[model samples]
Target: MIVDKKNDATGVLLRNGHIVLPDKTYVGDLRIRDGVIAETGQLEPEEGERTLDCSGCYVLPGGIETHTHLQLESMGTVTADDFETGTRAALYGGTTTVLDFATQFHGESMAEGLARWHKKAENNCYIDYGFHMALTEWNADLKSEMASIVEGGISSFKIYMAYKNNMMLQEDEIYDALSETKRLGATVGFHCENGLLIDVLVKEAKARGNTSPWYHQWTRPPVFEEEAITRLETVNALLHADHYVVHLSTADGLDAILKARSSGIDVIAETCPQYLLLDNTRYGTEMSEDFEAAKYIMSPPLRDKSHQEPLWDGLACGDIQFVGTDHCS
Candidate 1:
């Protein structure tokens, strides 16, 4: 296990291990004191300091989970895990920092929404946490509010392109948010989906008497997300701004990001473990009686089996930038 700087005065050391960093990994001895890294490489423990044998283990920085929904109220249901439970679980699983969304409701101010999230996680988190403001209404006032928000420590903002009738922002609204945030040196993330189209499809499916949960996947196919991502990137390219696409699930979507990058757009893709390990097969079929599949249901829903391997390869070749759990539970 890797030792992290959490307990400031607890002296902990890991002996003989491979340390992983952004550019390379190397054999070293890492030590921590008072919640700070005291030394690394060719280090001998003090007379009474504690040490753990890490001969074959890889000592890496704490995992930073970039996409998670804790204490989130969505889809007419409150997500099961709140900050207390979620952060504890993340720590147990080796994650030390989490960036969760502070969803600003349609009529509220950004600072109000951020403060609400802060109240929820303050003194409740086991590790560090950062909030990404989820902007719904983009206008002159909210654009002005973005400045203080960045100063308050939440430097990233994201727009939803997937929940049209809900939290999703429109084309012009998206462009406005990106432009304003970019001007503030803050990065924006997107939940890409052609929400207008999917909204129509969902209505049509329900009109035709299809009410099963599986219809979730049936209505919002990969094209919804892929197209939305491409559209957002096209807009972003015009702004020449740096942006991140969250929970990217489809091979086609990755292809769009790759194509944009080829033209000099700084597009970053974040993929969750579910996208890499799960696929549409879990939906079974219209005749199968496994409503349990709802457990796997999420936005940019799982893709085909054919896309999984390519995601792994994308990670290996730098086409993809990072891995997150998109942990909502």
Candidate 2:
């Protein structure tokens, strides 16, 4: 395997078949000392230590999973996976580094929320990690906290337009965050689903006795995502900020991002494997509206099948910047 040499005093050593670095590959032996990779290609074994024979394995860098949500508190409950279990699961999946977002609970200080996440992760992670603060509340104090947070290694910040009645930020609040993150040289991330409009639809659906899991996607269609994306793009433009849209699942949403970029806005979007592989209709009757089907629930819930082609095209043509599992558990 392509091993990191800086992880130990004796470094790393690899031999046998092929190893893939960030770029290029060599078929031979690699030697590392003191944790840094010391040599590569066919090598003679030293007198001390052990040797591993990787005859038919593909040696590559440890995977870096850039998006995940673990132990996040939501809707009067906390998600099942805490940082410990979450990080462990990531390691088990072959991920080496993960970037999870820290949430700012309503009425609590953003700094306090970040500190709490730190305590949850401290001494518990089996791999390297980073944080991106999720701004649910926008105010002068929290906006000002961005500078120090970026200085302290928590640089990226994201705001949601999807978590209506919970985390949706009004236009002014979104602009505040965009401007603040731009000032701090931090990238902004977006969850683009029109909250206000979806709330109306959700209320209407519930009033009509349509409160089922499938109604989740039924109430908030791709049009709402498109509208929210358009709104956020305008705000980001005013701030002259480059931002990332996370887990984009619909063609309309992708088109909004592409159009924004065409207009010269720095709007990078990412898709998740779930969206690429799963469709809304697959939820079936059992996972439809009742019971614990909520277990399969996520914000910006799965979309219809027609969008999959464009999603794949975005990935294949490199219009999408990256793909994440969006795996919380």
Candidate 3:
């Protein structure tokens, strides 16, 4: 392809290979100008500044990872990966964008929490990134602050059912937040598990001298997750809320979502590859040490293999619409 001198172009051609376009791929040459795909055709013009000759490799768009926690200050320590290191690793793994969360602290303004997160992330990220507000608490001020966050292009909010002693809100608060988000046309996400039940079980396990990583899964079993999802769904129904369930790890939890969606509640649920592939057994085995245990220790703790097939089926059938990394580094 030839262009006029005024039409300055930097051309790249991936010849004789599949180019995964929006709808389908075709064997052809692709030309770029000013970061936009200028043209696609045979003998694509080479008014080239630079070019990559993809003679036989698959050409695909970069991936988007929606859920990640890097340098996240939670439960008394910062996350293992800082923004620079984590974003570098994400780039190495082919993810070009991340939707990370900005967590609000109790007794602090949401704006301050967002600014804190931004300061931590702004200069360190290598690729594009955005924020989702994680509401550690819901008060009248924070509820009103949600509108400003939406206006600022941060439109998604998250809450938890699990981190009850610290981050989780009560049922009434959850209902209020969900209802407010519905009116604001924002999406709400949840970390759904029963913290109280898990705490009691953990205490009992420790009393029995079962304090290893394996006991982590045993303490906060899958039933707690299932029960939390059911409860959250009921609260959402009462408010007619729109929500996205994040990192759903158990069969029963996903089933509650499936049942809710079938009944016409706008509850969108998702799971990560780790949940589909890993199991609770790891906590007992590989992640038995203190630092190691902390690494694999996440809320909605990993479930056993019995939950795997249903999770995969949910993905295949579109019951689970999105695949996020849940990549907390």
Q: Which stretches of candidate 1 lie over 4 Å from their true place?
A: 1-10, 16-18, 21-28, 41-44
TM-score of each: 0.91, 0.89, 0.90
Winner by TM-score between candidate 2 and candidate 1: 1
Weakest ten-residue segment in model 1 by summed lDDT: 1-10
lDDT of candidate 1 at residue 196, scale 0 to 100: 89
Each candidate: how many clashes?
A: 3, 18, 2
Per-residue C-alpha lDDT of model 1 across residues 1-329, encoded as one tens digit per residue:
22345553558888898977678888889998876887888688887778988888898878898988898887689889999889889988889999999988878899889889989998888888888888776778898898899988888888888776677788788788888778889998888889889889989998997766667787888877779888998888779876899888888889888888888898889998999998887877665556587677777777788889989999989889999887785
**Clash pairs, model 3 backbone:** 1-44, 1-45
RMSD of 2: 3.4
Residue 176 of model 2 has an lDDT of: 77
Runs with alpha carbons beyond 4 Å of true place in candidate 3: 1-9, 22-28, 41-45, 285-295
Which lDDT tens digits does candidate 3 get at residues 91-200? Answer: 87878888898888889988998999899987788778888998888889998888898998988988988765688788899888988899999999999888788778
- Model 3, CA-based lDDT: 0.80
- Tally clashing residue pairs in candidate 1: 3
lDDT of each: 0.84, 0.80, 0.80
lDDT score of model 2? Answer: 0.80
Deviation (Å) of 148 in candidate 3: 1.6
Best by TM-score: 1
Superposed Cα deviation of residue 104, candidate 1 (Å): 0.6
Give the Cα error of residue 261 in candidate 2, in Å.
0.9
